[model samples]
Target: MQMLQLSAEAYWGVIAHAQAAVPLEACGLLAAVQGKDLVSEFFPMRNAAESAQLYRLDDAEYLQVEQIADARKLRLVAVMHSHTHTTAYPSPTDVRDASAFDPFGALLYVIVSLKHVDPVLRCYRIVGGQISEVSVEVQW
Candidate 1:
């Protein structure tokens, strides 16, 4: 499995928090140094799901991403979320939402599976709603 430069501590922290938000859904965005391969910032979003139907990031969240990129001198490299009862891979709804929503096709989609024994984190690039895996360097 591939890994992202995200700090293990931070990643696990977010995972635990996300998993705790179970049954509904959790969402967040990641800010990292442009091409540096390390996550430097994390922005969590509130789950606005109405019975398993998740809402896309609203305007405020989108604006916040731009601000973080500017302030941290990093690009909005990835968008992350947790899967409550499924695999780490994107679901049909996820793909559909990514196609119609994700602003930058350049950003990676990171999915964390809270249902497994050890949480599973997977990253992908969504192009026209087609997800392609992207590898990163991470340590155990």
Candidate 2:
């Protein structure tokens, strides 16, 4: 299994964004320095779908975040979104969309579940319509 390393701050940032979004799904991007597996930056993005069950990153915002990552010599390591009422696992739509958008199988798909009393965060790799969980290691 693959491992995803994230800073404590970045981990909490994802939770906070999920909580703040409330009924709507929150979306963002995670970036890491090239050649490193540790995630160093989080870019919260606008959800173009603006729905509780669906999310789409705004194109303009996506480009902006990509440029920012490029400037920092970082690569987009993952795409993150919150599930207001679903489990942390990928939904069918997520699987379909990920396969289409990430055909190269380069990006991790992180899902934050707000359905339970405590929010749950999980990471996955979706390629060719197959989904596999990835372990997350929070670094101090």
Candidate 3:
């Protein structure tokens, strides 16, 4: 199984952002130095869709964040979003939207489900409309 590494701070930051979004879905990017699966930074973003069941990264913020990551020598390793009332698994909409990503880039898709009392985070690789789960390692 493929694995993605994240510092405890980065991992918690994602969960916190999800909680903070409350009734709306939260979205963000996880960055890493080029060529590494270990995430080094987290960029929480405003949800353009502003819906409890969906999320869309603000286009302007996406571009700005991309530029910022480029300047910092970081590559966005994953796109993350919160599912305000569902499972951590990707939905059909997610698979369809993931087609917008480069098939060869190996980018990760992370979903944080807020259906239960505890937050549930799951990582996935969506390529050619196929969904495969990836393991997440929260390292201290």
Candidate 4:
């Protein structure tokens, strides 16, 4: 397993939104800060598709997230999306689509499980059409 260090506040915020989007998948972006080490910050993205079957980052929303990172002088660290009914693992489709969606390889895929009212989040790195578990630590 790999490890992702993130701010405590940001982690909770992501989980909150994930729960709120229950029954539907949630999506968001992560800003990576590089210092002595790497830390990521989560920024929520609106789920435009009420159906929750798909996710797309519009230019406006994308810009908003980018601006926030820019304001803090951070880099686009990762992209996150949730699965409503599936496990907190990447589906085959997810692996196939990851390449096009994230080319930088900095994108860490996060999946939230809606199997219960309280969702569970798991991180993964999709590479070469394979998904590998990534360890994550929520820093308080």
Best by TM-score: 2
List the candidates' TM-scores in order.
0.82, 0.97, 0.94, 0.84
User: Following a full C-alpha superposition, what root-mean-square deviation does model 2 have from the true structure?
Assistant: 1.0
1 or 3, greater by TM-score: 3
Residues 115-138, model 4: lDDT tens digits: 766778788888777677888877
lDDT: the better of candidates 3 and 4: 3
* Candidate 2 per-residue lDDT over residues 1-89, each given as its tens digit: 38999998889998999999989999999988899989978899888999999999999999999988999899999999999998999
On lDDT, the candidate that comes out on top is 2
- What are the lDDT scores of the predictions, listed in order? 0.72, 0.93, 0.90, 0.74
Task: Tell me which of candidates 1 and 4 scores higher on TM-score.
Answer: 4
Relative to the true structure, candidate 2 reaches a TM of 0.97
Ranking by lDDT: 2, 3, 4, 1
Query: Which parts of model 4 have CA positions greater than 4 angstroms off?
Result: 36-40
Specify the poorest-scoring 10-residue window by lDDT in model 4. Answer: 32-41
What's model 1's overall lDDT?
A: 0.72
Sort the predicted structures by TM-score, highest score first. 2, 3, 4, 1
Off by over 4 Å in 1: 1-3, 50-55
Residue 5 in candidate 2 has what lDDT?
A: 98
Residues 96-139, model 1: lDDT tens digits: 88877764576778888767778888888887867788775454
Give the 10-residue window scoring lowest on summed lDDT in candidate 2: 1-10
How far residue 20's Cα lies from its native spot in candidate 2, in Å, is 0.5
lDDT, model 2: 0.93
